[model samples]
Target: MRKAVLLALFSLGFISCVSVKNLPQNPSPYISKIDLVKGVKQEGERIVPVPFKGKIGENPVIFLILKNAEGKNRVKFRLYAGKTLREEYEISFGKPGEYYSRVIIWQGLKARKKGTYTLAIFLNESLLAIKKFRIEGLRQGP
Candidate 1:
């Protein structure tokens, strides 16, 4: 009885391990690390990032880093307020070699009301990343 229990437990563990190994792992191969910042400034040859928090002011920037990017590619940005789509933008790049650690920026996104907002980024029609932020304390004009 003891040997039978031990054999069954070992078989179950082996099956679990095999199942885990067979599971697919998927991650973006081109872009990583997306952030919403107040602004970015170039100091000498290095780019300095200013972190943004709480209520955003005029001109918020979307900063992201790219890796292993090659050929011609298109990146699309979609902004949403709650479930409503607010704005959409697209940019294209054509290069021959692989891009390792390239910084891309998007500007001119305005949030006029007080609510939660979502930014979705797509690379060549594939969804890459999403960021959520909130805006509060805006006075209505008379």
Candidate 2:
């Protein structure tokens, strides 16, 4: 009876090991901070960033603050205008295990249709964050 129990236990352990080995392992990317802000000048000196409130038009900015990002990671930043892609940016991380931040700004956009727009950020093909803002009033010409 003792030998039978031992053999069964051994077989169970072996099966567990094999199952674990066969399971797919993927590393999860971590983001500490993300904000969609509008760019405004303070006293005409420097631009200050503030959180978006579903309203923006002239100058829009997306802030991506990251932590624990390591090793050759590709990050994609995209801006969309009512289901149409406006701009895209891809940033690459060269070193491993570091913290970094990036701010993307759209300067002097000409006559965008008054509607809601989307800003999406992706890390390694996974969407990490998204934000939306709306432009009111008529389209301002360039």
Candidate 3:
């Protein structure tokens, strides 16, 4: 009985140490680029993130490039209006094979009010990146 108990403990120790790497949840995945850009513009064959003031009607874009991602990953986006949490979104990633790399583009977002805002990106409940931007004032009619 004592030998069986010792074996069980050793098995549990080995299982705890053996972890699947390259997952966003474990040890965190690698993020090559995370940018809050105005929009994606094609210059030649490459798309780039351009900086500009975010306006009310215009859509705010986020471009991200990730590496070392595996199957079934969760990404969360939070937009905080000052100290209050204003907007939130959850995204999933499922790509075949290991040593994964991909470019993710998020768009079609608008601000409700003109103020300073913070954008936070999380990978499987882990904070991956954060950005700060301001939405301009509303247009006035003459």
Best by TM-score: 1
lDDT of 2 by residue, 57-141 (tens): 5545665556655466787877788898988887776566554443333233332567777877788888987877777856357
Best candidate according to lDDT: 1
Question: Candidate 1, after superposition: displacement of residue 128 in Å?
Answer: 0.5
**Each model's total of backbone clashes:** 0, 0, 0
Residue pairs whose backbone atoms clash in candidate 3:
none
lDDT of 3 at 87: 81
lDDT of 3 by residue, 38-131 (tens): 6778889777777765442334677788776777788888888887897888878786554455655565445657788888889889898888
Minimal lDDT window, size 10, model 2: 102-111
Which residue ranges in model 1 land beyond 4 Å of their true spot?
A: 1-28, 53-55, 96-101, 139-142
Worst 10 residues of 1 by lDDT: 98-107
Global CA lDDT computed for model 3: 0.73
TM-score of each: 0.67, 0.53, 0.62
Model 2 lDDT at residue 81: 85
Better of 1 and 2 by lDDT: 1
